[model samples]
Target: MTEAAELPPAPQQAEAVFGDRFPEAVRYGELLADAGVRRGLIGPREVPRLWERHLLNCAVLSEAVPEGVSVCDVGSGAGLPGIPLALVRPDLRITLLEPLLRRTNFLEEVVELLGLDHVMVVRGRAEEVLGKLPPVHVVTARAVAPLDRLAGWGVPLLRPYGEMLALKGDTAEEELKGARAALSKLGVVESSVFHVGEGVVDPPSTVVRVEVGESPGGVRFAAKRAKAARTGRARRRR
Candidate 1:
């Protein structure tokens, strides 16, 4: 691990990105750089870029979301995008879904510190939490996985017309090209690349937006097989 970097107050430009939510956003950034790194949810080296690369990158995702709908942040490590979005959009209810206990503990602490009554943290994989969470209008993630696999996790969490807004960075188009077969199998419609926050952040945030259910069926992985595969992969990785 690199030398620990200090968590910063929201940079001056945070006001430009988050407006009145600047203070809370900064506080969240500080916690993420500090506790999040200490707990291994974030790397120590990422501290310097937390504000620009993580918080703002996630906050700007709000630009793609329609107003007044519930959202779930899939694999929400350190509450990127989810907590920031909630801070800015009181109209939306946000859930932070993560499978790891350490990440969830940190998220819960941050949620309470931020007084984010609207956000809840669930400690479970997306597959494990099905039927346990309310269907949300949008599902979101950042750096989670390839689109094909991410869609397998996210598409099932959406309401009939709900969408998955996966932040794919520079590979957005390439991932989209690769995910056609997966999206088709998953019953998604209108999958496209959306570049949000063009002026708010340099280079903008790239998102692959896909609506679930083309003909009354949403995308679903073979649950039992997926779970088994995930378990084997984890064991091997360990």
Candidate 2:
């Protein structure tokens, strides 16, 4: 078998970004470089730039998140923004949602090893877990899908007046523009494109922010949540 790729040192900016949790961040980087690549969760080529492209890139997303809120990271394959965000912002409760069991196992291990009690791992698609999981104040994603389709999965999991922070690349604005109608249908009241990690990272990470009003996930999802709540109450009484 070939040798495992080495994890690069964390950039100086990482300490400032992750604050007191810098050591945990380094461990997470190590895990991604070794186990993450071996497990095929991330490519070996990504190891050299793991700290910059993955950890730091995702940790900076904490700037856009609110002071204290619940966040759901949809399609959280290797816990990009979820784990990093948890490291930086312990004030926020995070749920890393991944459909694949292998990925979920990785996430649960990371959460446990890193002592990220504020973070939880759930194995299921966003749509499938809609009623089972409580709606969150924010949903974060990275390289998951196109803006329109990602919104379909992420938006419905949000609570009223919550927002989705998607980490996109140069195509952020273009995708936001193209997804206008779909966002509207998903109860997205406002949407825009912005950048985070300004001087910390080279070009900065582009983000597509989609905000929803009272009825998140639209009319159908509202009905589903209501029914789920009723079912839970009946089960408790039984």
- The best candidate by lDDT is 2
Off by over 4 Å in 1: 1-3, 214-216, 219-238
Count of backbone clashes for each model?
A: 1, 0
Estimate candidate 1's alpha-carbon lDDT, on a 0 to 1 scale: 0.83
Writing each residue's lDDT as its tens digit, candidate 1 over 10-110 gives 66667987787788887888787767776788888788888778888888898888998999999998887798889878888899999988889999999
Q: Candidate 2: deviation at residue 147, Å? A: 0.7
- Per TM-score, the best of the predicted structures is 2
* TM per prediction: 0.89, 0.91
Model 2: how far residue 41 lies from native, Å: 0.4
